[model samples]
Target: MANPAGEAARPTILRTPLGRVRGSGSAKSGTHHWWMQRVTSIALLPLTIWFIVALATSAGMTHAEAVAWIGHPFNAVLLLALIGLTFHHAAAGLQVVLEDYAKPEWVKITSVLAVKAVCTLLALAAALAVIRLAV
Candidate 1:
């Protein structure tokens, strides 16, 4: 649609409880992250629900039985994938939180990176453990 004469599109500024803020271009990087996070979240949703159901249905089993259930190829693979996706999502969220709150530049940078590293390691360790247990 074209604007009427003498009328121009005004920038949409968001008004929040904290204050009024304007949405600006994410500098490209932010848009990429936002997109990836949403994609991963969509993928994780089903996996999470599956995990819950799998656990619920097998809850009465013994420790060995539980282990065996997870040892199945499909279950093991999905579990590892879920762990990885979960960690990635968590890292992204934590980075945003840190960036929003951390005032000191050095502290913000270090904390965000540190949290990312930890989450990555934890995800890798979990995946490896699942693979080992399954195979």
Candidate 2:
């Protein structure tokens, strides 16, 4: 059926473990997540590409040469940034996925927290390695 203004729409109900909630397209969440994902994705694009190219260029090099390549100040800084942002992005994505799909409260929370901890640790390790190499 159409409204007086001639707009027809079907309402959506959100069924969650908490309870039933109504959904609104204009609500703050969707747009916020979308923007965040896009921004991080834009960051990852150049970073991953650069890392890939760096690896490709070093493919046939000796270990010493590869170490020397990574020891450059600019390269070390970029590597650290890439590692940190990559983990942050992964944690954010997995958090959203778990929040949306996981039905059990404990499971969802544990999974999200576990992912966050592991990724954070990995990112820190990566950054430290880069810094050590640079120094």
Candidate 3:
């Protein structure tokens, strides 16, 4: 359709994640979030494989033996990395889900905050456990 001047109508641009209908676009932080999720996933791959293999090899390790294994610098460091990346990735992914589906704006914001807080606390606890074991 043409306006009063007989010019063609403007093409409709794609809506953003929040469904904005104007020139408004990403808040500029999405790229960082996207990059972090990608980076964490890539880093988690090797860490997860190492963890699984290490666990498989030590299948029957007793409590003390497991503790001793964690006491090793190599094992402790890898375990810490695994915990950190896993939780970081988890929070990022959950935030995306919340942003996409949560109906109420306040609810979405609150849920995201809670998810991040819980993930952060869990990650810290896991790291602390690893450090305690290593000590």
Candidate 4:
């Protein structure tokens, strides 16, 4: 039906009593998570390219030569950034997937927390390794 102003009336969504009690609900953090995912993805592009080029250029290097390449200040910093962002992106993606598909609430929460912890530890280890190499 058209309203007095001639715009069609919008249909209203019918909710169950329980749903009505719950109201329009959300954790209110989806936007932040989405933005972080996008920002990390953009940051990874250049870092990944740098890694590929560096790897290709160092293809035939001996252990010492490779170590020297990584030990360069710029390379070390970029590598650390790459490692950190890669792990963070993985964790965020995994979290979304688990939240969407995991059936039990406790399972979903536990899986997300486990992913976060593992990613954090891996990133820390990679960063430490890079720092040791640089030093």
Candidate 5:
């Protein structure tokens, strides 16, 4: 109803003090994403070092010797972990980049999806290759 000598009153929806203060609050996923990124980065460090060392030491090995090296249980497991962590870390980083730099809404979403899909496919391929070698 219109107020006397004024425009109609606006309706008010009730909201808690916290909700008013914080707006809609966080998306609730930022912390989890941040933690995952950090964890993957930490995991990648040692795995990267091990990979470098393995590559360097294996440089002169014959093809059969290299395959045999990967067939070792410890090496196989570490290689798998390295593959997974590396791709995860890369995807996380790319996600952040796309979120920050991709302009249009569609572009950002598409970029993120593409990055995730590519990373997942690459990780799976690497894991399968390693498993094939190990077995």
Candidate 6:
């Protein structure tokens, strides 16, 4: 129907609930980012628990002992995984937030880039520390 301003009416969108959400991700990469976030978070659950328990068990231990604890193969491996996944998840989540909230396009792009870079650097540093101790 024509409006008071003599404008033509726009057609309503016809989409199922799922269809509406099918491509809601940034740059069509929503599914990948969403899945990775879930997987990393799930994986982190056990790793975090183990880390806490390990620390608790090692309470009052000497510096060398703590280093020794991290130096073990299994612990070192899990620690590395935790660091990598944590950073990945953080960068992904922060990018989504910045994309959604940042007003200027440049701000969103720069923020996402900065967040990812910082996360990468921190993860690498943590992994290196773990490797040094393990070695």
Q: Which of the numbered candidates is closest to the native, going by highest TM-score?
A: 3
After superposition, which runs of candidate 5 have C-alpha atoms over 4 Å from their true positions?
A: 1-28
Which candidate has the top score in lDDT? Answer: 3
The lDDT values for all models are 0.86, 0.83, 0.93, 0.91, 0.91, 0.89
Q: List TM-score per model, in order.
A: 0.75, 0.72, 0.80, 0.76, 0.77, 0.75
- Give the range where candidate 5 is weakest over 10 consecutive residues by summed lDDT: 21-30
Better of 4 and 6 by TM-score: 4
Q: Residue-wise lDDT of candidate 4 within 14-123, one digit each (tens)? A: 65668778786655785998999999999999999989987887678998988888799999999999999999999999999999999799999999999999999999
Q: What TM-score does structure 4 among the candidates reach?
A: 0.76
Please write out the lDDT profile of model 6 over residues 1-135, one tens digit for every residue. 899999999988755668667854345664888899899999989988988898887789989988988899999999999899889989989999999999799988998999999999999999999999999
Among all windows of 10 consecutive residues in model 2, the one with the lowest summed lDDT is: 17-26
Residue pairs with clashing backbones, model 1: none
lDDT of 3 by residue, 21-77 (tens): 465766788589999999999999999999999999889999889889988999999
lDDT of 1 at 20: 31
lDDT of 2 by residue, 58-129 (tens): 679887886787789888888887997788789899999999998799999999999999999989888887
Among residues 3 or more apart in sequence or in different chains, the pairs in candidate 6 whose N, CA or C atoms overlap within 3 Å are none
| Model 6 lDDT, residue 28, Cα | 65
Mark the regions of model 2 whose C-alpha exceeds 4 Å error after superposition: 1-33
Ranking by lDDT: 3, 4, 5, 6, 1, 2
The weakest ten consecutive residues by lDDT in model 3 span 14-23
Tens-digit lDDT track of model 1 for 14-118? 455344345443355748888888999999999999999888877679878877877889889899889989999999988989999997999999999999999
For the record, the alpha-carbon RMSD of candidate 2 to the native fold, in angstroms, is 6.2
